[model samples]
Target: MSDILFSLPVEQQITPCLTLCKKDELPVIVINHPKAKGAISLQGAHVLSWQPEGEKPVLWLSPESNFKQGVAIRGGIPICWPWFGKAGDPMHGFARNQLWQLIAHDENDECVWLTFSLEDNEQTRILWPHSFSLIARIKMGETCEIELESHGDYSFTSALHTYLNIGDIDQISVSGLGPNYLDKVVGGEHTTADKKLTFSGLIDRIYTQPESFSVIADPANQRSIEIHHKNASDAVAWNPGAEVAKGMADMPDDGYKTMVCVETAYVTNARTVTNDKPQFLSATIRCHKNEQK
Candidate 1:
């Protein structure tokens, strides 16, 4: 592979080494940072996140397991390798903490592929001990797509969490989780078939076998975000509520009232991929304008 370098448009450099793409009449901003990876932006228009740079990306979506945000899928949107969140091992994995280099750009198609490697590192070898190449490509067009491809010698756990912007959490309800659900926070064994799925209090649960799911109508923006996932076996939902949000240094107390994550993934010793055959998992969230008819 050739060494590739990406140049940022002057207008965006003041914020970060970012690039913008406008295609299919949609706009996207790609932030090229060593510690942060993946697409970070708002739909319909670009919006900045509350999280500071040089830290793990506030936005996450993955093909592994939904552990973090963008939905609540578990372990978050982190690539947990060697050991997921163990002592000496980085919080999630090196993927989110390492700076990704821009490998290629497709202006006509409106796409950018960013790549990161762990093949030549002593620190990573000590931790992961695997030779691999991870590429996260953000494509803007009719559908905003984020593709994570891994090529190497190990299997890992991952998540694609999405913090969806909705009119009001109180006005929303999720559908399609079949009969019972498993709660991972308490223990992986407890089950619930009693309560209808509603968001009001502190919630952190991994659900499975849903008929289908969606966010309720948003009167604030007259738009709702619809999510879809593939190659995933589970889902997660979360909100910090009041007390938890206050304790969190990363989240604002009021932030919980505006965003809710509905993640798509497989979590906690669910699956693994290796050198012989690499596997993939992904999720997509699309914003639909709830026009007045």
Candidate 2:
């Protein structure tokens, strides 16, 4: 685990809020800066929490989620690469289950940034059988940014699957996803949404032609979350209904009421990456008071 996870110099590690510790069997790095606070799990290199100063958390984490390797922790941003969902073995690709190398970390008065890397090895070869280097870069502070960079001579599908925390799931509405989408909830049927999406029970749709940015209006929290996408043409809106949510071991029976996943995706098809042409996708999530919108 020491080789897989990184620790800064003694001076940096001695900060009041920075931590490199093991949570159960998982190696996690916790942040407690004045501008923001969060936790990053080395298992899958997944972000388990991110909350900017004086506001609700931008990422939702299930209290029941396990903090161990091989299990996908339910929250923050999970990198789904080489494949999304059940399209490939291990469900959402091998990248999320492997230990990632912490390549860089830096901070300033306003924000903190951490970058992780994962290169193809014998382990990943068992899954997609591709040669590549994947990067998960994160910025935390006034706003949080997640970037996924892939370099290799193989094609892959990937996403920054972000689960946002809201005061109440029913009181939120998501807008800026273009009118049409592939309704995965209804077995991948094509549908049109003429208005902002308001969740009732379950909502799982792959929206097409989404604007570069979208808003998650949370009336209960008296704030709105802005999600920005880059280098990708698709976005996914999903929430497991009560029934399904109750069945997931990682989530509480009612966990679906406080979370929603809006994934910035390049998962419509496998994207080709040549030695000279790497692929990149990102999502930036920011929050502000409702009145400011």
Candidate 3:
């Protein structure tokens, strides 16, 4: 890998080619390099875009997503931590609403390594009283690798809420999920999927004891995506479908047709972590434009 340099925004002044910018007033770090390109918002340390060389976007972003402060964008790899879903106030927790610090970054011809950290504050303590540190380390290249670590004493459900884009939801199938899942669409009814998951209705299921790698086949786009993860036993597959997409103020009526959520998570009675034990999760996503089989 060749050594590369990028210029950062005058205010951020981090490095070369890695610039700091704003989108509709939200602070973001824009990475424009030879091997990778993407944008990461400091607010939540959330990845908004990651389009590697010679491939389509692996992440799905809602077109109508609001980039305002305190407003979580409707897509991308949302770090659903401390608690998942509506278990706590402010919807998916305040982590997405708060800003994080860029702790480290290194670049080469192959990829760029970035680490961001978010620690407990008065505001977070007010919501869920606990002192903790959340670190998100991302490596961008042909394959986007993300690792999340929680350093504290706590037991909470979490997920790397990832949204995968598809040419057509009806023509896609997610393989490698657990055989059994708790169907959220049918009020947490336990069920089993016969084969690869195909979207037809409002599908929201938490697949427990899942495999390490899942394949998302997008026949309409003539490509498939590989989602591999570690340090987790669960996966969440969500598609709002037609009927339920009607009431979402953040999502358009037809938005669900373009994207699906296949998150690597730990939602089912996540193991407790104390000062003696630190919790962590890692995942890597690779996109390939192979002809659909």
Candidate 4:
């Protein structure tokens, strides 16, 4: 740990507020700004945790998650890029599995911004043969925002797979997504939500052309989480439920009871990027007191 911290480039260290540290065997950026506290692992440029000064944690990280190289960290915001799901090899592309370079960072009275970059290399070429550059810019403060930008001549599907921490899955409801969705659990069958969504069992549905924002009302926690997105045509709502969670080695059997995924994505309609035109997908998250009922 001492060696890793000492070896960090001077430009990358912000001191007292932001610094490079080792978590297990992976390099992690620890944030201790006055307004919030958080951590980001370079392995995936993955935001592991974030908590505003007076609020509970907004992101969820699995207790059983592995903190090693080449393995997804189970929770938080995982970058599913280039292609989503089984559209390509290794599942969800290579962005989350590859180490990212921290190219820039800055802090201000309102927020701290960090930019991480990942470009196609020999390892990434073996997975998907393409010449490209990916940039992830994250802002942490009273609100958490992440923007993913792609520079290349290609069309691809991607997602900011954000896992949110809830007091209880059964006590919460999600709104703003329109009535139509594709249920992946039922083999991508088209379905309609018809109303605000409440979880009961395994729920994995892709809401197409939904509203720009979605809100999770959590009465149990006396708070609500709102996710606002841009440049995304789709949104995914997921909860593995009890049975599936039991089988996941990285998640506790009851993990589904406290976490829900409301992802910002471009799945059904892949975004195209050219040398002259770069594509972007972004999401901003805010947590506040729920309405009194």
Best by TM-score: 4
Candidate 2 on 1-293: residue-level lDDT in tens?
A: 12222333222363466677676777777777889888787777788888788886778888787777787878778888889988978888877788898878888898888888998888778777778888889888888888888898987888889998888888898988888688876676475656698888888888878899989999888989999999987899999979999789989999999899988997776789999998999889999896745
Task: List, residue by residue over 35-128, the lDDT tens digit for candidate 1.
Answer: 2333332221112221222222233222232212122122123333333233235654555544344545443333333333333266567666
**Candidate 3 structure, TM-score to reference:** 0.93
RMSD of each: 9.9, 4.1, 3.9, 3.6
What's the residue-level lDDT of 125 in candidate 2? 84
* Residue range with the least summed lDDT across 10 consecutive positions in model 2: 1-10
| lDDT score at residue 93, model 3, on the 0-100 scale | 77
- TM-scores of all predicted structures: 0.66, 0.92, 0.93, 0.94
In angstroms, the error of model 2 at 289 is 0.6
Q: Positional deviation of 97 in candidate 1, in angstroms?
A: 1.3
Ranking by TM-score: 4, 3, 2, 1
Per-residue alpha-carbon lDDT of model 3 for 1-293, expressed as tens digits?
A: 00111222434646775778767667788887787777788888888878787656667777677888888888888888888888888777788888999999999889889999999999899999989998999888888888988888878888889888789998999999978898876776475756699999899899986889999998777789989978987999999998888888788899899899999888877657788788988789988887535
State the RMSD for candidate 2.
Answer: 4.1
**Model 3 misses residue 230 by how many Å?**
0.8
- On the 0 to 100 scale, the lDDT of residue 251 in model 3 is 84
**Pairs clashing in candidate 2?**
none
- lDDT leader: 4
- The superposed Cα distance between candidate 4 and the true structure at residue 236, in angstroms, equals 0.3
